[model samples]
Target chain A: MPGYPPAALLLEDSMKTALRKKLLRDMLFARRFEEQCYQDYQVRKIGGFLHLYPGQEACAHGVMAAARPGEDYVITGYRDHVHALVCGVPAKEVMAELYGKATGSSGGFGGSMHIFDASKHFMGGYALVGGPFPLAAGLAKALKMQGRDEIAICFLGDAANNQGTFHETLNMASVWELPVLFICENNLYGIGTSIERSTAELDQYKRVAAYRIPAAQADGQDIEVVHEAAQIAVNHVREKGTPYFLELKTYRFRGHSMSDGGAYRSKEEVEEWRKKDPLEILLARMIEDGEITREEYDAWDEEILSEIEDEIVPFAENSPDPDPADLTRYVLVEDDPYVHGGPSKGGA
Target chain B: MPVMNIIQAVNSALDGALAADEDVFVFGEDVGRFGGVFRATDGLQAKHGENRVFDTPLSEAGIIGTAIGMAIYGLKPVPEIQFSDFIYPAFDQIVNEMAKFRYRSGGQYPCGVTVRTPFGGGIRGGHYHSQSPEAYFAHTAGLKVVVPSDPYTAKGLLLTAIDDPDPVIFLEPKRIYRAARAEVPEEPYRLPFAAAVDREGEHVSIITYGAVLHEAREAADLLAENDISAEIIDVRSLVPLDEETILASVRKTGRVVIVHEAARTCGYGAELAALIAEKALMHLEAPILRVTGYDTPFPYTLEQQYLPDALKIFEACETTVDF
Candidate 1:
């Protein structure tokens, strides 16, 4: 690890104690929230493709930590609950959206896969395989065009790297020197197709390297590793005003979605990845290194559990469904552009 | 009013939008330096600068997907597809991703994307170049489909589409790019989405749109000499269909002939006839007849026979009137 930067380069050494405690709490919130949402799907409280982010807490915490709250933009494919949560969308609003409530982000129109918070710069979770690739490039182009220093972080899956958008957008970003960070949260498999069966190269970062965009890989389960790698990637995009590819090597604890049986991988493989559980790695290391007492960590876990079990769950369940008449809302914005001379009513 | 052709009108529309709004940008394959193969975007890059007017790789999905991102992030993107035939690659981005952004996000995110593509037959561009796919975009919900037939409507509608808050499929009839000159206003104006009655008569109402509007006009003139008064209604917007004008024309004329350059199978003409039957069937003096392109792929050698001409519309009008 000589040429590699230190794991905790982004975080201050003096604030290690405080950071350890906060990082654990952050991961805990995502875990408890996803745990409840999983149950919500079982009882029909949440529907559609309910992909949960139970074990991949570090990837969100570490990668999103590099994103400036209201400046840098973040976009990802589906399986994107924690990214929005980490980006500062209120848990209540995120849950309400999952519950299909008008009070939720996206007015409850976008469910799990399509969370959007424009103000927070968490653009949305694009549902298509590689659709957001070009969108991310466009956003970076917009940022540069408008003379903004902000960059765009596009999170694609391992399987998504094979998509044409990945190659096309990468080349465009490199050619134009647009500010973009293409992060691949390589969780080994895309639903059922593992990286081996899908990509010719196991390293997703190498595929996009053909465009002359520098590439890097990090331990996605380790917050410190992911954060350090993300900081470097984000810095490169900002300084060079071009794109850089980063592959955060990680694994998903849950199935691809609620309905997925996950018959593709063996139980042994899942167990092996579980041993490197992101939450446990930080919790165990922090306690052993005396960054925090065991009691303090347990208290934080209790706080997160109560927050979800008491507050977030009720907020979602009690949230009101959208009005029947308002069903046509958001199909277009306020001004009826077609109203100048077209038909009296638009076809929704 | 300034005399302009469809090509000039479209260019004027793009120039107007680019000059007025800093957020409006245009890009596509060979659109920037080459002025586009059809020159619909000629001189735009020079006037607006490379940032506003630029060329993108020949990837339709890349053009549309990036434009969608720009639209979501507070830019009005007018992405040209080069040709409608090259649009299938970006079909998912345009149809599903771009079209559903507003609805799926519950209105929090409405991407203003005006995808400009040239589509139609009669140019001998064959299967790859000559294709009319308005029905595909028209069938999709949450999309405004505009097919401008002449210069006046082309300039006015493209400008309106660029300003519209939602996604609009602005399909220009490539066959009529330089078809004829028409009186277009020097300043920016918006045309109504409602269909216009191009010619008035009592024998039959010829409901048509896009390139076929020309043939329908000629066919109406031929019908006039034969002592038959034919009315032609141009449906400018396929989605926000001017059902009122079409129905009223059908009721008054008491006979109908539908015309389009797309395949007869599942074409927009079928939708028009269905509407007339459902709404104005009682007023009909004869069953509605259709004059459309063949169901086969746009042919290379026999392109003339594959395309719908004025004679086809006149023959269909004859059958409807005789019935």
Candidate 2:
């Protein structure tokens, strides 16, 4: 912004302006959406476990910015409101999903963690830690078998790195030369434990080289940095039909969730990360580079805040709760045409 | 037509499916270069490219879970579990995901794939390898369970199982993999899931499947020598059981004995016994009997005692006639 950095010159002014506006809108929408979830959690409007994706908004928005909407598949862990939102899941529906309403993405069956919109190509928001790993690998295999150029994007936290499934999935993805982008959102701490204390190899993408897979590490806090790095990784995955790994180094601003007491990390560390907030950084750049006036950035923030106030929360509040009778509707099919359920008049 | 064993029939079925449909692919442990541990998928990788027939990581969950995803994307993936005993690791994938996918998705997606596992107690595989777990799957709603006793039915039924719209659990009796051989049609054929009446008689009815079918046959032979006529029925498919054929045989025979190598408490045999008792109760001359493996942990050393053999079937038949 100050001196037209050589890397920054690669993007034209109009392209940069449009990208900045979209990134701000999506990231701010995610932030405001999750912030409303925190409020809903306190009021008990949304029950069960709720994981927030506050500071890691840039990672989801940045990656989806590079990947296609309907063509690609997106899978992530429980902290997936932002991922679903970035993939074009209506903010109101995602909020209602957290509320466990009938209008939610999964018809209130999956609650917060198991949200899925097959039509939108958001494969799932699997609750089990690292449970989506093998599924992502399979999705990549399916895409490859169908001779499609689309890739799969799988998001995992730092804690998932310790799971054997993580290794198993990566190895299988690499061996099959599947088109998948494994995005490890290294937000310093997984749930509550810091990465250094839990994980042996802190640099996760470097671990992929042992499996002969291509990988890179980028700053997760910077939207443009993440977007650019992801573009390269996504392109490489699509062109080569091989797995690509990305370890985005970022930090979560809030506690793991509304329940966390913030006892796991220091206030000083949290403040330090908050200082480099992605939204603030983008706003500063937009102002300093003369890309937009301060009024525009203020207007964008107002729009996100007003949308969260007037759209997502109100829609969730007005949404109907799931009917008790329909609780067991999806559990099993009452009449499966494939297998005769009750009695068969025997004859071959 | 070609005469082959159970394993050879499986290989033929896989080869035929792969050649017929470009979407059909096989992957599992030792399935590619080694042609599978039991050679059930023999020579598939060589004939088809590695892309179609490949070996996967030694992970049951991975194999089953990935197959679910592949099936959702319109690919017909036939994953091998090496052995039925080893499929427990994938129990969640089978029970939770694959079994419930169609229903859970509100019919938006169906897990239309096949899982081929070798089952039954023979060849002295002991507890780990030699066990019949069909009852567990039979309890599942969305799954189709079929056990092929001989090669001819193995090929035809396996082809049908592969092409079935729903997920099918094709359990081949590993004990009879090479022991049982028959002439199978060279060209494709289909075997309906209903029961096949092997021998027709008027005195007693013997309903069985898999390894127990051989015992029933031997017992039927012995009953014939003793001047007692017995009808033999082989239930090719356990889930979509051939109740009509079984009831018809029992009505004619006026007596029934259900046999299976699985534990006695609650097996597919129990289901068959209840079905006969419910439908053809008026036709019964005596009470229905069941001769099954004892209800105990499949003992490693005492497998012979734990398993029901031809002698037990003969004893049960005699008791049924005496009653």
Model 1, runs deviating above 4 Å: A1-15, A337-348, B1-323
How far residue A47's Cα lies from its native spot in candidate 2, in Å, is 1.0
lDDT of 1 by residue, A1-348 (tens): 122356456445323566667777888888888998998889988765578887678887887776675568989987778888888889899999888787788776677777889988999886566778999999999999999999999887887775677778988999999999988888987664466644578877767657888888888988877777877888888888888888888998998777567666799999999999998988888878778777887887888888888998898889887664443344356455421111111112
**On residues A1-348, what C-alpha lDDT tens digit does candidate 2 reach at each position?**
011123653364234687888888778777878888888889988865677887788898888888896569999987888888777788788888777777888766566776788988999886556678899999999999999888899999877776568889989998888999999998977554566644668887877888888888888888887888888889889998999898898888887655566665888888988987998887788778788787876787798888888987888889887674442244236653332111112222
The CAPRI category of model 1 is incorrect
Pairs in steric clash, model 1: A341-B192, A342-B193, A342-B194
Best by TM-score: 1
Chain B TM-scores, listed for every candidate in order, come to: 0.98, 0.98
Q: Find the candidate with the highest lDDT and give its number.
A: 1
Candidate 2 residue-wise lDDT, B1-323, digit = tens: 67888888889889999999998989986677657767787789889998999876546787899999999998999999877987887898999999998998899997888999988775444445677899999999899999888998899898898788789998988878898888988787789887899888878898888976887888889998998888989999998887788888988888888888887667787798788878988998887787776554443324556566777778777887887
